[model samples]
Target chain A: SQKIEQNSEALNIQEGKTATLTCNYTNYSPAYLQWYRQDPGRGPVFLLLIRENEKEKRKERLKVTFDTTLKQSLFHITASQPADSATYLCALDVRYGQNFVFGPGTRLSVLP
Target chain B: EAGVTQFPSHSVIEKGQTVTLRCDPISGHDNLYWYRRVMGKEIKFLLHFVKESKQDESGMPNNRFLAERTGGTYSTLKVQPAELEDSGVYFCASSQDTGSTDGYTFGSGTRLTVV
Candidate 1:
């Protein structure tokens, strides 16, 4: 069976600092990996997606790095703001399947 | 453009009852997906519909759940004789194109509490 894991503990950092989150998976070779931001009482909002062949992807202050060799992906949010506090989720597209498997997600809090 | 929308933002039902959840995907989106997240658990995929056809339903837990996408515009998920473990938040998402790299737009979600 395939499994995805993220930092279970909530990450707290000061505003304007860089926040790094990790996502690791086992027993699956995904075609693409994606990251999403979810706030309390709301659905997840997509952030970035990186293919297995791609090394890194960026959007605004967010950067995502995919290392297929280690079966891990790293998501970074630079100059984090108080408004950036939320749960970050990592999802992977199952090759040839319609469903995407998601990790438990890591909660981030940026204090001003 | 409007994002995906789900009806009855919150629902409370008794065990063994039937509940139906509705999702209206963004207009012109060809791919619609259903996902659920239980308390303290990851969001898990339930099913996918592509233009009124069920592309994949492998994530459906059991025979008590049924999902339909009529005319490929809106979708419905019905759970009959819901169990205690069915309490969770259900989300609906859609993408404009199947092959594009664009991210999906998700609805606010419907929180189902099975008491």
Candidate 2:
């Protein structure tokens, strides 16, 4: 079975600063990867997806990078705000999105 | 368009009791998936339903869990004689096709607590 790892420690940063979170996996590489934002008591909402062939993708202030060689992905929230405070999860999809194997998630807090 | 919707936002039941969680996927979606997250743990896949059939149920923990997607419209997950360890948040998600390029849409989830 594949295993996904993320920082368990909560990350605290000042609002307006950039927040970077990492996701790493072991075993075979996935066909694609996705990032999600989960608010307290709510399910994860889709943020972005990057295929193995894609090095980087950006949507507004959100950016995601995929480094298959390192078996890692980085999620960045630029110009972060208090609203960005939530648990961010990275999911690995194999066999053409059968679909997802999610990491434990890293809770980020943007302080005002 | 409405995203996935789960009934009974919260459920509290006693051990040895039964609880049923309902999930209605987005209209026209052919794939539905169920996942659960225990307190302080990672979210784990339970099963996947393609239309009215179970495509993969390898993640279902034990025989105590039953899932159905009759008519391929809505789905139900029943935990029979729920145990204390069954306490967790159940999430339902849906995608239009097998290869979900748009990503899956998840519901708010049903929080289940067994005492």
Candidate 3:
């Protein structure tokens, strides 16, 4: 089975600073990786997706990078705000499977 | 458009009891998925339904868990003789197709507690 792991359980950073989160996987190389933000008492919302061939992708202040060679993906939020504080999850679809596998998620807290 | 919706926002059942969770996907979506996240654990895929057909259910933990998508509109996951380990937040998601670009829209999820 494919397994995914986030860089940390929780991360705390200042509002103006950038927050970086990592997702690592083992066993297979996914064609695309997705990032989602999950707020308390709610489901996750899609943030960004990066393809294996693409080194980086950006949506406003959010950026995601896929490093297949390193078997990892990094998610960054620039000029973070308190609103950005939430649990972020990384997910990948198995090439041979119908469902996606998700990492445990890293809870990020942006201090004001 | 309305997002996916799940029923019984929360459930509490005694061990060995039966519990059923329901989900209604967005209109016209062909792909509906069931996922669960145990306490302190990552969300895990449970099964996938494509227009009333079971595309894949390999993630289903055991025979005690049964899922049905009748009429290709709504889905129900019934767990008979539920165990403590079955307690988790069950989430339903849907998409027009399997394309990663479209992304999947998720429901608020049903939190289940088995004691």
lDDT of 1 by residue, B1-115 (tens): 8889999899999999999999999999989999999998889999989989998898899999999998989999999999999999999999877634777788999999999
Candidate order by lDDT, decreasing, is 2, 1, 3
TM-score between model 2 and native: 0.96
Q: Write the per-residue lDDT of candidate 3 for residues B27-113, one digit (tens) a residue.
A: 999899999999988899999998999999988999999999999999999999999999999999998878557678999999999
Q: Judged by DockQ relative to the true structure, which candidate is superior, 1 or 3?
A: 1
DockQ of prediction 2: 0.77
RMSD of 1: 1.1
Every candidate's DockQ is 0.70, 0.77, 0.65
Best by TM-score: 1
Could you estimate the TM-score for every candidate?
0.97, 0.96, 0.96
State fnat for each of the candidate structures.
0.74, 0.72, 0.64
Look at candidate 2 and tell me the lDDT of residue A97: 57
Give candidate 2 misplaced runs (Cα > 4 Å): none
Error of 3 at A84 (Å): 0.2
Query: Least lDDT summed over 10 consecutive residues: which range in candidate 1 chain B?
Result: B96-105
Can you give the lDDT of residue B93 in candidate 3? 94
- Candidates in order have lDDT scores of 0.92, 0.93, 0.91
